[model samples]
Target chain A: MPSAPAGTLYRGREGMWSWVAHRVTGVLIFFFLLVHVLDTALVRVSPEAYNAVIGTYQTPIMGLGEIGLVAAIVFHAFNGVRIILVDFWAKGPKYQRTMLWVVVGLFVVTMAGFLPRQLMHVFGGN
Target chain B: MAATVPDLAAPRDPYARRKTTRSNYELYGWIFMRASGALLIVLIFAHLWVNLVSGEGVNAIDFGFVGGKWANPVWQVWDLVMLWLAMIHGTNGVRTIINDYAERDRTRLVLKLFLYLAFTVVVVLGTLVIFTFDPCPTDAAADLLPSFCSSLPG
Candidate 1:
């Protein structure tokens, strides 16, 4: 039992969610990798055919899709780095708490860097 | 009866038994896994539905389909975000796995160096493709150009 008591944040649950995300992202990224590789192979299949296939990616709806994908990737990468630290360094536990904020800081910086253009597209600004 | 074995007390250094100095890295890492993961859940599902399940379904995807998506700046940014996120996520996740398995200090360093290198290559190339993709390329020359290109007034 946690000494922190109920009604407050559940510490264990937080860790559980992280583990689950790590696994789930693994599977999803693998699936996407397959499709991406196959699509790239189309380049050898003649220019017309390849161009046609790539063209659909330009659609607005799909544009949003891309945003969602990149976001998943960035988050997974940053958090993954954090996990690596914990496993190797014996001192990992000492900084585990503060590292959460670092990851968030990175996440925010990443999103801020890209959001302007992303929102511009949705709003039809550029 | 179990075989009896000799028990010995190992000498311990004072420093070895002392609580390690703090760094809070684990706390952050643990938090990141859950938070990013929660977000990935929505992003990942939305991705699948649009690409594989929406109107015309998977068959609807093709070169022209992709070109169309990127023509809109929306997708350019979307892809940019997804690429950044997944790459970071996968890289970080792998880093975790690496630390867990690789014991030697030198080995860990070498492996991470490679991982980051691969991450950089993929991210840079993917971003370039997203931003530079051309839908209506006529550079193949008029003879080899798509019929649609020929019909458009120059």
Candidate 2:
């Protein structure tokens, strides 16, 4: 099998990297959800405040951030299913590496489908 | 005899008793993560499509926009399920992290205590907000209310 470069993260097994990515993505989504809940709750106080807060999200910078959020969520969800298969399926453990590749493929496809439309909306003029 | 020092870097015994108890709790947690993840994809994506991708996109959102959505029972149920599932899934994931990394009993307990506390607060507050939300209130100042609410008979 081909090897990763010496002294690099690539030396780790697919499962290891999957775990690391899962944790990172999970944390990112968690914080994002926290902020999201707080902002949505603002509608109770006043619509003006809620609109003002959401207004900031329409900017170019936030548009880019939305892509990153979507990527993190896709990775986490894909790898999470892989983990479930590994645990539950009779042949799962044997094909975990294959599953990881499948997860990567799906993530790429989904993001590719998403990015163009998102960019048009973001960079598209008012 | 010279004093002997244990090798700190040596591999631990594979057969050693586990520090934490073995239970079906982890099995349940694992299952919950996948189940909630599947649901989140649909819930989250639809939410994004409506709020960010649909006609006029994010700029169209405002108090009235949200009020309009929540006026429908379908959207209300959708938001409620999304809130509960995502919060629980995220909380459990963090709990796993704490269990794996916190070496000390006290540290693990403290961390989990706070984690559960936050989870409780969010879930409780979120559920209340979803179910109890009233866009137009007779008690609220008219200026703060949605324009649609004013159009309704007093």
Candidate 3:
């Protein structure tokens, strides 16, 4: 028999990269969720307290940050479905690479739909 | 002529244990991730639509806006479910990451300890906030309260 290959099975492939993105986004979302809950909890303290914090989120910088946050969440959500299909569908293994492209396409369409409206909200005075 | 069939089920070593020592805990965790992930996609997408995409978008979110939404039972329950499911799902995801990266036993244990602790605190605090929230606190300025608050009888 021939000698085995030197490199790893998943080196720099789409599957590996998507897996990395999923983990990174998942961790980022988790941290955001923790802080989100805490910020919402400020409602218990007082309206002023809550408003003071939430007001910051409405600023231009944070509005941009919200875009990034939503981008991460959207990618994670789509990729998560791709993962589920890969696990459960009969032909999933055969088509995982194709599915990644589909996920990217959907991500682009989604961001396209979201960006304009959100941009107006952020930059449109009042 | 009589035909004899051998017992295919018989173990080669009679003294050896037949069953595996493995439990289904990890299997169940794996399934939970997929199931919860599917549900969270819907829950959170709708959540984003309402909170960030509709009407005034992010600019509309404030104490009064939150108070208005939580005033209804539907929103209260919606948020409660979202809070619980998201926390559990996120905690479990992080736990998996910790297991993968943290090679040392002590390191894994300590990391998971904090993970679980944060999960419990966030879940409990979020649940309480949703259920026990007073949309119209009398002490707060009227301007900060939802418009409907002023109409309610004290």
- Which one is best on DockQ? 3
lDDT of 3 by residue, A69-125 (tens): 999999999999999999999999889889999999999999999999889999996
Candidate 3 lDDT (Cα, 0 to 1): 0.92
Clashing pairs in 3: none
lDDT of each: 0.63, 0.84, 0.92
> What does DockQ give for each predicted structure?
0.08, 0.30, 0.60
By TM-score: ranked, best first:
3, 2, 1
Model 2 per-residue lDDT tens digits across residues B33-146: 888888898898899889877776766677778888888899999999999999999999899899877877999999999988888887888778778888886766666566
**lDDT per residue as tens, model 3, B1-154:** 2366765656665766679989999999899999999998998999999988999999999989999999888888888888988998999999999998787799999999999999999999999899888989988999999999999998
Lowest lDDT block of 10, candidate 2 chain B: B1-10
Q: Residue A104 lDDT in model 3?
A: 96
Query: How much is the TM-score of the A chain of model 2?
Result: 0.89
In model 1, where do residues sit more than 4 Å from their true spots? A1-126, B1-29, B140-153
The sequence of per-residue lDDT tens digits that candidate 1 reaches over residues B1-154 is 3567566456563445557698888888666665665565466556655764455444456555565566678767876776676667667777887786687789999999988887787777777777666555655544434345556776
| lDDT, model 3, position B116 | 96
The model with the greater lDDT, 1 or 3, is 3
The recovered share of true contacts, given per candidate in order, is 0.13, 0.52, 0.89
